[model samples]
Target: MQQLTIVTPQPERPKRRLPKWLKRPLPSTEMAFTSNVIEDLNLETVCESAKCPNRTECWAQKTATFMILGNVCTRPCGFCSVPKGKTGEILIDEPERVAEAAARLGLKYVVITCVTRDDLPDGGAEHFYECVQAVRAKTGADVEVLTSDFRGNRAAISRVVEARPDVFNHNVESVPRLYSRVRRNAIYQRSLDLLKQVKDEAPDMPTKSGLMLGLGETFDEVLDVAADLRAVGCDMLTMGQYLQPSADQLPVERFVPPEEFDELGEQCRKLGFSMVASGPFVRSSYHAGEMAAEATS
Candidate 1:
């Protein structure tokens, strides 16, 4: 008879255990204080939203990367831990609240990032401008805005440039080849174009971009991406080991050693970047104020 053989599906392999260097100490009381400020003001931070490995360290130091708009992201990138779905009406008071949080935290420099709000008309660029203005007016702090691509809208990008934040950051997140798997809805070239546009409009602005290593990208591929950033006038770069946030996210392909990150940082410096931060715990905003100061100095 034409009976077919039964097929058995193989089980998925277990995730690799984190290396010793990836382990962080438990959150301190200062972290609780930072959490209380965010909670009291109902502010959102990428540190918490993305399940960042450096949340405890950053918060304990009384610094945070504020996430404007809302917590729900519109993109379903494979590696992010931020929740994705439809969001409510934009929080009109968010800018003011973010200002208050920075003031209360006694911050001299603030970094504001947002979820990809594709639902918004300007991709939440106006809100970013408002937050930048609000924080500057409220605390007189140097502001850095890490923004989404705004669907490649030039007008929207211009509006943010007009706000005149101290630093402009947009993370490429991964190399071009990995876009389909790592950044599902994002276009690699589109991101590069956005950075270029920022520099085009505001030539003196210090533009920055970040990359998450350990997602099966080659060492040469990482350097090529750094070169791409430099070609667009990107001034600062941050590279970090990508840790899978959870079981649902993409698994880690490799654990890049600490020395590799150091070497990459050196190479990027040779490519004419003014500032480079690369390490297992390096996020776009980690020690961001210090990096900005050194770059501008």
Candidate 2:
């Protein structure tokens, strides 16, 4: 039997202190409706659950991607802070609540994602579709489904794509060689195939993917990923530095400077992506709609 190394590396301390410009103010803008929407819907969000640094900024703007299915994911990925094991049963009414939240928040766009439901036969694809439909029905906003591989279920993937969300997103997270270290039970080629399938299946709806750098990935690998994404017809690309949210999560390899991020943006543009969100703090859904709109224009 092959012995799994399972080396739990210590979280690397931030190389430098936060510059004044990098410091973010606390979130004082409370949207009571936002709280009510999430509470009423009983949805789990990476913002609140994973302790994303931008949760305050995103929520203060009255925007949040509704995490459906359940908060608990089936896979215990090395880099993720989301708790693992024992994902609860699918919530039938969660879709309605997400729609109600989007409608109540007056959101012009809604981004939805979920934990990987490996136990489910369809890998929660139908559930993602139902939520997108409900959000559209209730809010009438352009929807973005930031999804998983649906465990490579083509029919399940089609069900979500056929729902026709304005944007379809599936993040590759990192380069192929880092797959075992970054994502558990997720194949790099399979993920690329998912993006390819989205491009083939839903040509009109913009397809997007993202990767987190500073995970020991090289400049060449980053460019290679950009080429691969463009090859799969991914319309938008986001590259950001990996910030370890917790002690147990993956550590940052090296702090990438903002200039390097800018360079990456230029490389992404050269690789055929019209839109590239590349920065130390930029995330896939941060200003997603506005950034995506630029690509179409």
Candidate 3:
């Protein structure tokens, strides 16, 4: 097998200007009905916390991916915008509130994700289990969980798996060589192990993972990561451009062209991912419901 070469990014790489393809129109109905529901229920969403480019479009469509375990994250990754430091106390009623918001949104496929809560003993795994259970009990909708690595705690990972979300997602984020800079506290192998555990615990459950491009990763590196995921029985994959959330975060290494995304998608398909979502605006939770449906189909 040929070794995939790692591209060493320069210490002071010039910021890549945003291209026209990345431009999105302002939200016409900024505070749509879904926004009101989430505000009323006092629920947090990754779409807002991560400052996802598709938030306006998803919100207008009255669909959202819920973010539990508080707004602040314990781990400070360079590529993420979620706030760092002490996240304060965990909200006990958060699970119920999340269920309420899902009910209000009338979502048939509910997606739940959380910040890395290294402050907690179980890494907030029990809270994730509770949220999945609450959503299922309330709406009887199919649930999908995009979770942290649980700090490689198999017991914590098992706790969430016991809840049995319809789809299990753990994003690899970037290539292994870029893990140190892009994902500070996260281990690339640990993420792969997390996804494998899902398949191990419940073979029938569809497992999913995501990758973000334009972080100075070579195409061979991206394909190698995809191959790694498929080897572990990962059923679905999402590949998208990594947009730097703020000036304080990691700057964008480059803006991947749309045509390149299509080429990547074709490569992923050949690698045996049951469903692949690849493009500039494709986030892990963007069109999550459709992704699950497609994966199962």
lDDT of 1 by residue, 57-101 (tens): 888889999998899999999999999998978888999999999
What is the lDDT, from 0 to 100, of the residue 198 in candidate 3? 88
Model 3: per-residue Cα lDDT over 237-279, one tens digit each: 9999999888888988888999999999999999888999999
TM-score winner, 2 or 3? 3
Between which residue pairs do clashes occur in model 2? none
Off by over 4 Å in 2: 1-22, 31-33
User: In order, what is each prediction's RMSD in angstroms?
Assistant: 2.2, 4.3, 7.4
Worst 10 residues of 2 by lDDT: 13-22
- Comparing 1 and 2 on lDDT, the stronger one: 1
How well does model 3 score by local distance difference test? 0.91
Candidate models: Cα lDDT each: 0.94, 0.85, 0.91
Reference-based TM-score of each model: 0.95, 0.92, 0.93
**Total clashes for model 2:** 0
Report model 2's TM-score to 2 decimal places.
0.92
Stretch of 10 with least lDDT, candidate 3: 9-18
> Model 2, 1-297: lDDT tens per residue?
998889899876655455443466787887565767778767788777767778877887888877888888898788888889898989898888888888878899888988889999999988888998888888789888899888888888899988998899999999998988899799898988988988898787789999988889999999998999999899999998787878788877877888899998998898888799999888878888898789889
